[model samples]
Target chain A: MSKGKIYLIPTTLGDSPINDVLPPKTIDILSQLQHFAVENIRTTRRYIKKVIPEKDINQITFHLLNKHTSISEIRHILQSVEQGIDLGIISEAGNPCIADPGSLLTREAHRNNLQIIPLTGPSSILLALISSGMNGQNFAFNGYLPISPQERIKKLRQLEKKSQSEQQPQIFMETPYRNKQMIESIIKTCHPETLLCIATNLTLSNEFIKTAPISYWKKHIPEIHKQPCIFIIGA
Target chain B: MSKGKIYLIPTTLGDSPINDVLPPKTIDILSQLQHFAVENIRTTRRYIKKVIPEKDINQITFHLLNKHTSISEIRHILQSVEQGIDLGIISEAGNPCIADPGSLLTREAHRNNLQIIPLTGPSSILLALISSGMNGQNFAFNGYLPISPQERIKKLRQLEKKSQSEQQPQIFMETPYRNKQMIESIIKTCHPETLLCIATNLTLSNEFIKTAPISYWKKHIPEIHKQPCIFIIGA
Candidate 1:
């Protein structure tokens, strides 16, 4: 029997409307699939219901794939595909495999010669980069920064230096509650002329996406505590 | 009068259907905008008609922003926004600003304090990365590698070393016709055990996406000549 293809489905970021963020065909594909490997079961089920109100939640089988999911469990999920049952990886927000545990399953899919299809949808990292007016041609995503203050400051300096040398934009995110501290570290560790873009509340109402020099950010301190943010440092 | 915002619009990759790659709201947004800064006027008009066949093409004003477009011309496009006329940037394919000159206009928009809205859509780079199942948590998009054979080999060596040291995946592309030569350089320059992913014709019917070690690729050289491709090197 031919194996089922693994679809890497993308979810909306924050509270953005489904229609506004996802293609119509994404909904169509989701309704047809009966199995999913999701990060958060509650959010994924709710999202599925919200997008396709008529979809029967009871008919679907979801496999948990959070921090605690084991390799054997992921292998089992792939085994279901080996039985010709297609499965999808759904993240709580944004595209799967990006800043999520979905990559573990995707890597396995590649290892086992499973076909992987990545759908088009909202990605805060990509959205933030284009909107920042920074160097999009060459950029790096370093995921979240070091939580320790000293290490975070050192990392910020290294990022700034690399950006200057390579002429490439550096992208990094922070824990929601620690966003304010992240901004301060960026402002203090980088030169005054270095550009810093702070993109917060993406894809939601009252979104704030702006890029300015460190000096300007220092003079006008932003109130972004508790808000999810993507920071980019540019030469 | 309030300042008109700049919208960063995305176009479909290859011959993929519009509905499959873009949200319905994107079409709605494009039809409402009267001015566009595009990489190619002919292709943009053709794509606009293909997506919204009922819309009147005569009402739209297209500003040329290709290789010959000067800084002064891009500045004029932004100036139109000063008159409260909203404008959109449309690339030849995929999202604007990445691997295109659209960012020059976007950078000026940021300097002038114009609000920029980047719509979510098909980004080949992001799609390739997600589908590759590599280290999406930390990766870099380095645009295109050096075209010269010697420089290309040296660059591949450097990329492989960086991927090994930083444990970060490096992504780069090549002109369509030179894809075969690029693969040859990668196979010859990198270590046998290094992982490489070749994603070609993404979001199309005959899409080919796979990842394997350099040794495997050497044994099975891909016939990706004249096909647009994204190459990724992982540790």
Candidate 2:
């Protein structure tokens, strides 16, 4: 009989200083894992070195598990847990099974009856939602807008209509460089009265969560074209 | 001018045992607050003493604050901050401002331009949503449904229809003791094929996050009528 084992630890939001705020017990658990499933092996190695500097952490090899990984790799992850090996899964930042990369693995872990453990840490989505003061009762997170301007506008329009009719909040993110275009699309396509929330640099020294009507945004965010940001519209 | 003062600091769920899981810096911040505004000052004081035994937290008084407190009392809180006093806001458990008691104070703090610090902690709603594998992209937290079954059902039906039509996720909670009827109501009113998630004992030893179609839940959930659960229906 194998020991029950599964760990889903939260990493920090990649570019924030608060990104380094993992609990001590989580670090202790990381050191105990027989194999660490990391989104980026190089970055994971550096993070571990910072905490456990004197140890040979490289002995515990990392299995890169990103979106491109084959389904076979998921099976190996399940197999390792079945053998009683504690497996630590982490995204580049924030909670793993969230809007981040580890949901597929988490779904499989659930099916296999593995003991899933969720550790505490920074979560950009929750922070944005709570502070947005929009509707917290009913909200949806649309991961990323289409990069093409036309497609992005089309999706934004659909989201806006759905959000308004249902009185539910709609949230989405954009690449650092494409932020301006996304904001512009929101201004052009969304109702001027629509409530828009921009949460940028969350949990960092410069964390900001701003909520304003769409018309007000056009006047202020003239040059915010390219920055990694989470945009929210409350119906 | 007096130094900028501390504001509310909501922590993770469960007993203070979970507090041990927070980052070290968070603990340091909690310690520095000269005053803690909590639902139960005694409980908060006891929790602080248990977690950080060496620190004499007696000098840091706790001002009991709850939903019953008046607007003038809220002003008094701000006045203390103006006098260079620090404040820590804690709920019975979990993060504040999520249908919790400290929201008024939080708003007041924001209006006053006081530096509001939100610590990364557990939120039952987020825990339930992420683990349930429901629609995470957009969610609306309705807080708690009406106590009367008829009103509750009406709200549930409205939410169900809206969710289905808009593809939005609706979230709500019930007191721990009222968990059973909430589940039954959903099983009877929501469509048989509708997806429902029941998250209970979040961040606690007995925590469980369960999901199933309403029809399946109707037949399987004999012990889950009123048990302090958060229900999620994903359209």
Candidate 3:
């Protein structure tokens, strides 16, 4: 029997409309699958219901695969795929296996020689980069910076230097609650003339994306408290 | 008057169904726009027609923004947006302003203080990484590799070393016709234990994606001549 495929499904970024970010084909696949390995079972259930209202939330099987999931447990999750049962992996938001715990399952799926398919969907990082007007041809996504204030400042300086010398934009994000502090740290650490782009609430009706010099942002800082944002710095 | 927004549109990867990669909202936005700055006028027109067949193609205005477009011409393209006319930027395939010529227009739009909006759509690089089972939290997209054989080999070795030391995957692509040669160079240059993932014809029915060590690839090489492929090297 052919091994079942592992599909990397993408969810909406925030409160964006379901049809705005996901294609009909993705929804079709979600409706057909009965098994899912997700970062958060609650959010996965809510998202599935949003996309497929007819789907029985109670009938679907959900396996936890967050940061707390053990490596051994990931192997057990792939057992279903090996047994000819197709499985889907969904993150809390955005595309799975990207800045999310879904990669653990996909990594294990490869070790088991299972076919992996990634369905099309929204990705905040790509949306931020393409709209930043910075160097998209060459860029590094460092995920998140050091949480400590002092260490974060040091890292910010390093990123600025790298961006100027390499002519490559540096992309990173911070926890939503710390979004304002992250922006403040960027303003306080980088040179006044450096270009910084902040994209918040992407794909939503209240989406805001702008890129300007640090000096310009210092005079008119936007409120991004407790909101998801992707920051990019370049010369 | 409020400045017109610049929408960074996404085109299909290949000959995939229109509804498979793009959302209905994107099509709605595409149908409403009358002007577009595109990498290739022919492909952009074909894509627009596929998505919005009822629209009159002759009524739309297409401005070429490929490698040959000059800085002065880009400034002229933004003039329409400044006049309160929204414009869309489309690449030959995939998302605009990403390893494509659309960035020039976006950068200029930012300099003019225009609102830049990136609609949700398919991105091949992100799809490849998400499916590669590689590091997605911290990764770098190096776009295309050097063309010279010696330079390409040196770059491949550098990428392999970076992947091992940084624990970050390095992604790069090659021209479709040079797909096989690129794979040969990678296998010949990287260490046997280094993991390499090759994803080709992504989002299409005949799509093929695989991840394995360099040694495994050397023994069972796949034919991918004249195919769009993304390669990732990781430990």
TM-score for predicted model 3 compared with the true structure: 0.99
| Model 2 DockQ class | acceptable
Number of backbone collisions per candidate, in order?
0, 27, 0
- All DockQ scores: 0.82, 0.36, 0.85
Model number with the top lDDT = 3
Off by over 4 Å in 3: none
For model 2, the stretches where C-alpha displacement exceeds 4 angstroms are A15-20, A69-73, A133-138, A150-169, A187-195, A212-219, A222-227, B2-8, B37-42, B53-58, B61-76, B79-85, B157-169, B190-195, B213-228
Better of 1 and 2 by DockQ: 1
After TM-score superposition, the amount by which residue B95's alpha carbon in candidate 2 deviates from its true location, in angstroms, is: 0.9
lDDT tens readout by residue for model 3, B1-235: 8778899889999999978888888988999999999998888888888888899999999999988899999999999899999999999779999888788888888889899989888888999999999988899999999999999999998999989898989999999999888989999999999999999999999999989999999998999999889999999
The C-alpha TM-scores of every prediction are 0.98, 0.83, 0.99
Model 1, runs deviating above 4 Å: none
Q: Write the per-residue lDDT of candidate 1 for residues B101-139, one digit (tens) a residue.
A: 888888888889999988878988999999988987899
TM-score of A-chain in each prediction? 0.97, 0.91, 0.98
Q: Per candidate, chain B TM-score?
A: 0.97, 0.92, 0.98
- Which prediction has more favorable TM-score, 2 or 3? 3
lDDT of 3: 0.91
Q: Considering DockQ, where higher is better, how would the candidates rank from best to worst?
A: 3, 1, 2
